[model samples]
Target: MQSPFDEPGRIFSNKRPLEEDYTPDTILCRDEEIDRYSEALQDVIEGFGPNNVFIYGQTGNGKTVVTRVMMDHLQNETHKHDVDLTILEVNCNKHDSIFNVLLELVNQLRDPDDQVKDQGPTKGYLWNTLYDELDRLGGDVLVVLDEVDMLGHDNDKLLYDFPRARKNGDLENARIGVIGISNNHMFKDELDPRVKSTLCESEIFFSPYDATQLSEILDHYAGLVFKDSVLEDGVIPLCAAKAAQEQGDAREALDLLETAGNIARKENADTVTEDHVERASDRVEEQRVLTIVRDQLTSQMKLALLATTFLNIDESAEPRAKNIYQVYKNICKTCGYEPRSKRRLNDFLDSIRLYGLLERDERNLGRAGGRSYIHTLEVEPELVFEGLEYDSDGDDSVLNQAGIVPSPEDTDQYSLESFGA
Candidate 1:
């Protein structure tokens, strides 16, 4: 018997280039963004002091990568001029609150054995400690907060304080600058006016990549990751086109290409073809849908989605709001939980619609009739069942107790009319 690890896969020569955290040696199709970002950081390298920069873009639009590239350039240039500089980066996704953000910064600056504990420290104490450490360092310091929007408005004091530390006398010896990177375009508007003014002194926005740009990016990565002639001519273009049509996401395009390569390797195919890409697209979409359903949706939202999926499978016609509410109530009863009000249920439906799991159409009847909303599941019924079968508690969920299995061909077990809608 041969070990799985013993066999060398012919599809991918190196997979690191396809990973999310992998930084390419050269960035393609982002020259303008790089130039703007370079200008934003010019003061840091020229000894004028650091500038606060706020970068906004959708996911996979090269916001973080461009920041990293610019930071590298800034560091290299600063070294040439013998300038005193310190760079600190904290991902706000994990350290979300001001206290946690401060704690993380202190830990990064401190030795591992002398790091602060997670609890028992007040925000003011943390602030003072952070200021002391910064003052001790005594140079131009740039702090990067990635996923800055995750801090929300509650933790925005860091935004206002870090950029104004020098002017406010919080740090006598050290000068502070902040670089905030966020995926939400509206995050800047939500900040306090003072914080917004200081943090957004220089702003840059990254637009989604078009098909041509995605294709170029994909080709660059594919050439580095795959063996020569392993990819069919159409594979990159198909992946790029599909991703561009959906959201113009370069990350998704790259993932699609990588998944296609893995699929070909699994099948022992010599070359990655368009058929492999089509299958990989379905697989990637299913995984994405499952992740949203399991992680993002609340319990009530899951129930509402399951109710819609049941209707989508059992009824020939799309389910109306009234019909779904009735079925939703029954499911709640079967699960031994109280159902929310019909109005609240509709809100859940709309929320799920926003997640791309469901479709909603508004219709109006003529002659004094009110509006009606028709709902349909955007994904297949099987995916919804799998998504909801396991609750977060690791216990069997509503699907198990209700004995409801998704059978698109068999619609006799449940009916919308049975619920007296």
Candidate 2:
């Protein structure tokens, strides 16, 4: 059962710290936000009442992590006084609708013998049940709703009633406090004015960390993730700098380092170096584009995109939608799929433009010709082609024929009629 040839050294000490849910014991560069957040929840600590907190910021900001850290500290402190404090955390992304959220809450609270079905109860009945359960608990309850923007599927009935749990006489013993976390700033503004007033009583806006803050965050995680001296000099700085420019995302920085460490491990390299980080960055960017293509686009849509990219790259064709559609039809035949109608193909192009994979502009034709749209790839043409190649199985004969890799000069060259067909 022993395999001596398979044994190899790892560059990472631990990988848990790099994961999204793994909150480091010591949070870096968020003291000010944490202090303000704690103060917002001071009422719960003083045993006076509860508070409603609304936290909003861009992705990768320290909103959710900071809250979790403070919640841990709060729980420990409250337990010392023999207080019955319960924490109910729900990611609205996972449990989006009112019914799903209520069902999950009841599932967490109710006894195993009295477990509810996946879905059955009316909205009112569910709320009544939740209040009854919380009241029975006879303690302070903190319900932290992450991804609050996705709640109730376009309605805020649950959010409106969260802070009003006590006011509406839903609970008697357990004082319910709600903390709503959202990355979408418009979520609060679009809410009912009444809900907005109460839910956002203590609004804490978390700004993105600066480069120095990101660097500090990277350093903290690097020390935890890597062995004592296996890291190279410039790896952290480069990762930090890249992340800083991209909204100062600490998660992005950690991901870069993790990917670099993985690259080093795979290559059997001695140490994680700057070159590895550079390659990792490219890998991340490629994955980013590839994810958009592979996840969001249909098979025919990808073929259309490939055709457009080929036209843009090889033929120096006009970026007009019509021109692209002609090449798209040609590519569909090459790839053994029936080409879609022009109307439907234009719809795909519009969606691609919306995704920012490509850009579009309305162009005015002469009096005889009607107006049309011209488009260009927002990302590098080669990157999109490469991403498409990675997604495609087996050999890409269409890409080869289209000269995506730049073909040698041929005496007998194809005419524009072939591309149009």
Using TM-score as the measure, the top candidate is: 1
Candidate 1 lDDT over 1-421, as tens digits, reads 8666535758888988876678888989999988888888888888999999999877788988888887887888999998889999998756756888999999888998999998799989999999999999888999999978767666667898788988988888888889999876767886789889999999998888999999999999988899999999999999999999986888889889988988899888999999999999989998777767775566677778877876777646558798788888987776676888886686567557755788888888556757888887888777777777666567776666666544434445665554443
lDDT of 2 by residue, 329-384 (tens): 87777666788778667656754654457777787887876898877777876566
Error of 2 at 261 (Å): 1.4
Question: Which segments of model 2 are wrong by more than 4 Å?
Answer: 1-6, 288-421
| Superposition error at 366 for model 1 (Å) | 17
lDDT of 2 at 383: 63
Clashing pairs in 1: none
Candidate of highest lDDT: 1
The residue ranges of model 1 lying beyond 4 angstroms of the native Cα positions read 1-6, 289-421
